[model samples]
Target: MRVLFTVYPNSLAHLYPVVPLAWALQSAGHEVRIAAHHSSAELITKTGLTPVLLGDPDQPPVRLTDDCAPPHHQDIVNRYADVMGLSPEGREHWIVFYQWLMQPTSDYVRLDRSEAEDLIEFARVWKPDLISWDATIPAAAVAAKVCGAAHTRLLIGHDMFGWSLDRLAENESALKAAGLDPNPLATLIRPLAAKYGYEVDDELLVGQWSIETMLEGLRLPTSTKKLPMRHVPYVDPEPFPKWLYERPEATRCECCGRKNRRRVALSLGESTRRFIKGDWDRAPKIIKALGELDDLEIVATLDKAQLADVEEIPPNVKVIDWVNLPHLLPTCSALIHHGGIGTYSSAVAHKVPQLVCDVEGVSLLMRLVEDGDVNKTGTYRLGWEFDEREEGAPDAATAHWELPAKKVESTVVSDFVISTGAGVRLDHRATTVEEIRDLVWSVATNPCYRHAAAALHDDWLAMPSPSDVIPDLEKLVVQHRR
Candidate 1:
């Protein structure tokens, strides 16, 4: 069977999980291709997949500014408020749900209309037996409907899309009464689906099935069929430094390196470093905080720009412009990152205690002020900014000691870590330098954390591999294309 995969054109992360699956299929002697805006064609080719360009390559990207949708869009905000009642828990969940769902939908709507049109037209020509698309690319469902192909939403993190689905399920009556379509994605993709004579529904926004990369228990319950996939990280294959395969003179890959010492990997995924047009600077302060611990070596994978403001580099801190996360993860005691899917997945895969930082994509976590001085629409500014408006889920977890996996993607991993007694939610805003010092100390010294991390590692190891899913997908195709 021939398979085609699509994603939101500009996202580098969206394609990672999809690539491995495509490789698995191709190795099984199936023809595979990647379809997206031509801008992504070269990236797809670099992955050793056939590139099927859908939209115009030269089209400028669409971005959302604070001004793009203003207070006048009270209908959007009020509608969300209506869906989530007056209860504080409802409001909190709404904040988490709304920011995540709306941000992407904002970008998706602005995608050149021709992007979707071109993809649909290509599907008519290619007639792929199966279409597995990034959940962010709503157009793929429309294409699948037009070409009579089976389709599924492929996920990178905990299914935020599923969270939206649950909100709909919880408030079905209110949503229906308001004449609101429960799925924001459906609302985004419906017009295009209608163009192809496909009636918009939940399935169109989601898919016939979903291929998820999260570990077992963390996956949200959803109406769509779920395929549990072990997130085998596929960084561009690289020759590692000799020290990676061979242990350093003073360090080991086990037990936080040297028997008496601990090494924390201080790193951020690419997006976090460039977050919100590179507005707020947090890396230097983070490095200095981690540096205060004497019993440690900090292996920070950072570029010169991230380190530009740093004058006094700690002797124990080693800074590299870049390094493969898989190589670095196995050698560290704990990881501090900006809650990116790839970093979190790598941390879990290796069973390293993780400290998810609130640098980006954490909206509701802001310190709310009594006088309505919430830090909304700001980019990664540190320090406590939220005040209790009306007590709901009182007492948030500490940022340095534990980071909540609050975002749609991080929640499952965060929950898993906390559930196993392995880690905690990090409140970046309120955490002081001393707190960060203590947090890493606890994560490194605590045997419970190590044991829990190991158990999670085993659970992840037990999941089906990229190659292992081929037979199941083959069966799925047989059923779908019948």
Candidate 2:
């Protein structure tokens, strides 16, 4: 079978799963082609798949222009200098803020349309049997419709179906207003029925041929409820190495050349950094905390800009600009992150205990932590509060009062730390010079935390790999193709 995989170009999350799936299909002797932004072409090619550039050719590259200064600095500038005066809730204020923040993303999406048209043209020529797509890329759905192929939506995070329905409906309305059909699922069955000169009910089109049909086609196990809204599925834990369970004491991986077996990993994705900046002095805090640790090796995956910001590097800290985390994580201790779903899932698959630091409500890290799937570490700036004296000044006092350092409700850090097989949740109150030094020493030198983390890792490694249970995801693909 030949497959065309379409994905959103904004982030790495959409690209990761596609790579593994493409590899799986290729190993099974199927031809797989990828359609994405030119920026992601290299990434796709690295996975040994052919990349087809979609959308506009003349679109300019996007740049990050926000002052690398802290949020307080930016807020001050916005309040004193900008006309909006820090009233983010106001329509005009939001318009300017979002336009500034999202300008690059908007430009990228605009370019994506031209690329999508190119993909549609390619599909016309190549005539693939199946199309798989990241749910965010509507263009993929359009191409799938144009090519008369079966389409499956991949969810990178939690199942997007439940709370996403309203957003989907809104998008559908916008597309319809723009004189497009808006429903890719309808394009297939409705067009065929039209060709036979028959009328079809829209409800049946959506219920039978749209969302429900697509889910059924995927061969996903059914939930107790019939409605999509009631049937959001939990992500299954990922599989790890079998040897991890047999030998709980085994920290070093013989297969991969990793040593000094601290099992925890940290993902410093861009969004997480932004959130941290809003709350406190991120750079100094991280440096202070990490500097105190001598026994445990702290591995941080950071971008070049962030790497450059580190003035003094700790001897035990290993900094890599990028890594194949799925390949690297099983060898580590636990995952400490600003909660992104991709990172969360990767940690879960390895059964690595999560110390989540939520920077934004856009990501559901807090929700997951509250549910006991992962341990929550910190609070986010929900929004700015207002004061009567200064109209635009941030309600800094409210933020200070409301935001907890870590999300774990327990009074004892030891209990929270030892019970979950994860590291100590850093208390913002205790994040002063002396407290940071003590906490880092405690986490790094503590044997119990490592033991708990290793035990969890062992449990994760014992699970059956998808290869063992599903054997062939292609069968699911083929069934959906019909």
Candidate 3:
């Protein structure tokens, strides 16, 4: 069977997962082609797939330029800037930020439509058996509908788009424009059947649409009569550090190759960029705390701007501009991160304890730690808290104190310290340069965290392969043809 895989172009996240699935289909003796933004053509080609460029070459890139203060400092300006110009007002400031957040997908949707028009022109000449699309690609469903082909959504992280459609029934207008209804399952399956001029039984659509509903509906196995749905497919690169396999037996740190070296991985998501940029002063304090540690090597994944603000590169720290984290995280001791779904899943896949720094919304980190027996496995929890000072409480003390004591909270503080578990709860108030030094020494000298980390690593390595969870792709092709 011949298949056309579609993705949104902007960054590596949308492209990476689709590659392996395309490769898997190709390896199964199916012809596969990929369509994406021109910027990502090289990356798609690197995956050994043919690239179909999606947008006009002369079109300008979507620029998210705004005049307000950076995100970290938004709270400071937002409090007083209400009296300022319209651009600086708190309400207007958030509107700009929200627009920036949606810019990538919004821009890609325009390109997807342009690309789909081209694909429709192409399909009139060369037909494909099926069309598999990344969740971000807005046009693939429509293209499949117009071309009369099977359509399937290949998820990378959580199904954000599908979830949004379900949560905000207000998206009915957008769905209608895309030829879908408010019903997610029908929104997905009906288009393909209509395009193909075939009568699809509701049962087959339900069975095939399991991946979409299982995740979006938030229905766990015990709560529903439906069979457990397969997890999203991920291609794990091999030749991983042997310690990941030998875990409890390999009593040494994988990165430093030292039994004395304490291992921890810091996975920075997009939210970290927002918080760090908003509060520029906190960078120095974070650096000072990191610098004091001799035994601790802070492996931080940061964006270009965040890396620029980091003045001194301490010997104990390794900064990677970008990396394949899903490949690198399994060998780490613990993870410190902003709680994005990708980072969360990587930590879970490795079974490593996590320190989540939630900068917005209700504290997801606290909820997870409180609900689960995380302390037993050594997961730590901490978050930035904010309380508006009434009148004149105190002037800003230092970079550390500028955040104020009321602005930070920990749910499982004592459990982290006394439990001898796999995680450490770094108190934002007390985590001074000197304390960070001592904690690093303790983690390096102690054996408990490493022991637990290794045990968890081995268990993850023993789980069923991601490929095994789904029906064979070869079988899907045969069934579709029949």
TM-score of each: 0.81, 0.56, 0.58
Candidate 3 C-alpha error for residue 411, in Å: 14
Each model's lDDT:
0.66, 0.45, 0.46
TM-score of 3: 0.58
Lowest summed lDDT window (length 10), candidate 2: 361-370
Task: Rank candidates by lDDT, best first.
Answer: 1, 3, 2
The candidate 1 region of ten consecutive residues with least summed lDDT is: 394-403
Error of 3 at 401 (Å): 26
- In model 1, where do residues sit more than 4 Å from their true spots? 64-75, 86-97, 106-112, 169-172, 176-183, 246-259, 277-282, 304-311, 358-412
Encode model 2's per-residue lDDT on 1-482: one tens digit a residue: 78888766534555765665566567777788988766666667665679887654454223221211112223322322233222222322222222222222233223323554577679878988777665445445555556666665544433323222323244665555555444333343343334334444332222212222111222222221221211111222345435333322324556885544453455655443333323233444665566665545567776544454456777666666565566666666555664444554465455455555532212111211122211112333323211112224333323321233332212222233345655555443445767655655555446675566666445444543323322334554455453
lDDT of model 3 at residue 298? 67
Off by over 4 Å in 3: 60-104, 108-113, 123-125, 168-259, 270-283, 326-331, 360-466, 469-482
- Model 1, C-alpha of 391: deviation from truth (Å): 40
Best-fitting candidate, scored by lDDT: 1
Residue 68, candidate 3: alpha-carbon lDDT = 15
